[model samples]
Target chain A: MSTTLEPTDRTRIRRGRNRAVADRTELHALLADALVAHLGVTVGDHPVVLPTAFAVDADGPDEGGTLYVHGSVGARWLQEAGDATVCVTVTELDGLVAGRSAFHHSMNYRSAVVIGRARVVTDPAERQHALDLIVDHMIPGRSATLRPSTRKELAATAVLAVPLHEASMKARAGGPVDEPEDVAAGIWGGHLPLTRVVGAPVVDHQTPAEVAVPDDVRARALHRA
Target chain B: MSTTLEPTDRTRIRRGRNRAVADRTELHALLADALVAHLGVTVGDHPVVLPTAFAVDADGPDEGGTLYVHGSVGARWLQEAGDATVCVTVTELDGLVAGRSAFHHSMNYRSAVVIGRARVVTDPAERQHALDLIVDHMIPGRSATLRPSTRKELAATAVLAVPLHEASMKARAGGPVDEPEDVAAGIWGGHLPLTRVVGAPVVDHQTPAEVAVPDDVRARALHRA
Candidate 1:
């Protein structure tokens, strides 16, 4: 796979062109860090955007790679997404840029958008792998410890694969950019960094007392902090 | 306005009906707490989803209320969005639910979807008000402290307003819900609560030496922590 992202006509960045990032590595990193992605699909004449858990396979069987998103088989949007053009977006808010003037106030964020025609996963082996990737994406080393999924469970889930060939990323960081006159006003101008903090685990009430928090869970909480 | 959200055919919750929220107050609270919104619009045959800062006015001049999202006036998507049906989604991921079985794993999140035809804000006063709300939404009491937007700055920004009448919200909270058989296996099952933390201000290097961090910035950083 190429190290740089090749933006197509649809993926080209027009506005805020200065913030556009062509590095595929940055796109992969942003996807790995974000917990949720919003999937957009056209339903009839209008569009619908819903949040769902997503995972990516950098060397999967697709044009560039494969991006996987799963939903209940009964979900109407999931059924409508099959063989249809879709857009998936993941964003991380980094900070609040407080400029000397309101016109310059903005946000520090990293956002990625992927556009492709989604194909429903039909092969049992590939579907299983995609499901495991989704699970492990949320908690590292999680799917390895779980038992094999039952047939009923497998039948109840639907996985959609979107080729990562057409993807774009944009990010903004650091302090606010205020005008020279505003800077001369001697007012406060800066940014407050935002972060996602993971707290202690809240054990399920039904879990047996002998069952302890897994090593992966403990490590993730501390690593994210 | 009605106290409860009236979900239209497009806004109805078809899957995970248990997590659907019907109260208007809950929708307002979710919108207020969220900092970014994903806007989905159909450009030609495909859909495009992008993240942008958003604000809501509960008593604004719209059907139920008004949702404001701004972008560069030269943006292609913003130009296409005028008088077009669009979907706006805001999501807050609360926790990672670690179920004993991979099939049952999910994330606890609060998500709201609004579907409507966006109208470009042409009125000068309303556009100015919307811009102020967007700035204050990021930092409370921020817009009041800054100078009024210059005429050139106002001309360079485009604001789109979507009515909140056809909106729906769904949220999942607490621990994982696993099958009885998986629970009997005596494996760990719980959730790790996630939170957004704000760090100390990073003042711009160009700011005058005498300038100090403003009270609003300090208060928001501490409050969000």
Candidate 2:
């Protein structure tokens, strides 16, 4: 498939043939696993990429086809993304895959970048759903536990819906790039792995004493630790 | 102090006078927390930012103050950073600190971006030390675990030294911003905390039964999670 940006000649690290990827399931998995994404917005010629905690809002029956991203209506950058076309990139590094030779050293990583135009959602009815998506993005089932959004609180948030089909994910995982000659020379090589873990959750000092951790939250805590 | 970049300007994220910071200790901590950074280089205004795994290399006793970064010499980007004026950024998002007001929605984050010209270190002895800095950057004691680099490997690695004085770190930690008009809205807001955790060490399935997890690696694993 032809890319909208054509891998601009100078920006292409490897050849288009080397870096181009075509896979949907792989892309979805990457989007689901990442908790944050670096958003790049360009005004004039300069581009500023800011990392933001984000969750993917999949298309639903009642919703138009748009990837929902909710952030503080007060945030300058978030407001920009909500109003214009932007690039969202999610990346995860799996490990340091060592090669036997200098040229062979490499990393195992998965990265996905999506480009789309978004419009701020102002409808009162849709605003609550957007907040629900944001809440669900963090703790899957916590939306039900928390009180629903009030009319005033809903107005304070800005939700943007960006179409998600125009996206791509690229990944390289496995052993290092080792030249046969280097392997024979017997230089030690392999992968130094990496993983994300969550420590024990610290309860909020202001949380009411009567409330206990919900089942889903407890399960997530166990997974994180 | 006024920043060259304006706070609302699109060309860059201009530092607010109160938000801008210049401190070596803060810079160092941000760098220590980050394992990968986007090294920005401008080749005659054709700017490019590439992600690379890096480790800190300390300038020796004689050098009043400089920071060293280690990477593959074969990687043109690393070599370029060694000789050119560049900006290296390290950022960590501790939590999404929400406040009672829309304007106050903020985050607990620490970020350091060093803008400077990197000096190349070519001495054989200094090169070895630089390599050690890179190794120890990942695992403090593991540098001693592996055999020393061969002459060829050392030649292929690039070590760049940059003065720390020119660098700065920007940090923000607090609750949300609520307009006085919205003070009585009674919306719940605080922090949606975040952290990087290490999980159970998934030892290589092929590892021999005799080798056990090293103490330094164990400490790091427990500390981050």
What's the distance in Å from true for residue B164, model 2? 7.0
- The TM-score between candidate 2 and the true structure equals 0.66
Model 1, DockQ value? 0.85
Q: Using lDDT as the measure, which candidate wins? A: 1
**What DockQ, on C-alphas, does every prediction get?**
0.85, 0.17
The list of candidate 1 runs beyond 4 A from truth reads none
Error of 2 at B189 (Å): 9.2
Compared to the true structure, candidate 1 yields what TM-score?
0.99
Which tens-of-lDDT digit does each residue in B62-140 have in candidate 1? 8889999999999998998999999999999899999889988999999999999999999999999999999999999
Write model 2 residue lDDT over B110-180, tens digit each, in one string.
76555556778888887677666665665556566555567777776777776544455567765445554
Model 2 chain A worst lDDT window (10 residues) = A1-10
**lDDT value, residue A138 of candidate 1:** 91
Q: Which residue pairs show collisions in model 1?
A: none
Deviation in Å, model 1, residue A127 alpha carbon: 0.5
TM-score of each: 0.99, 0.66
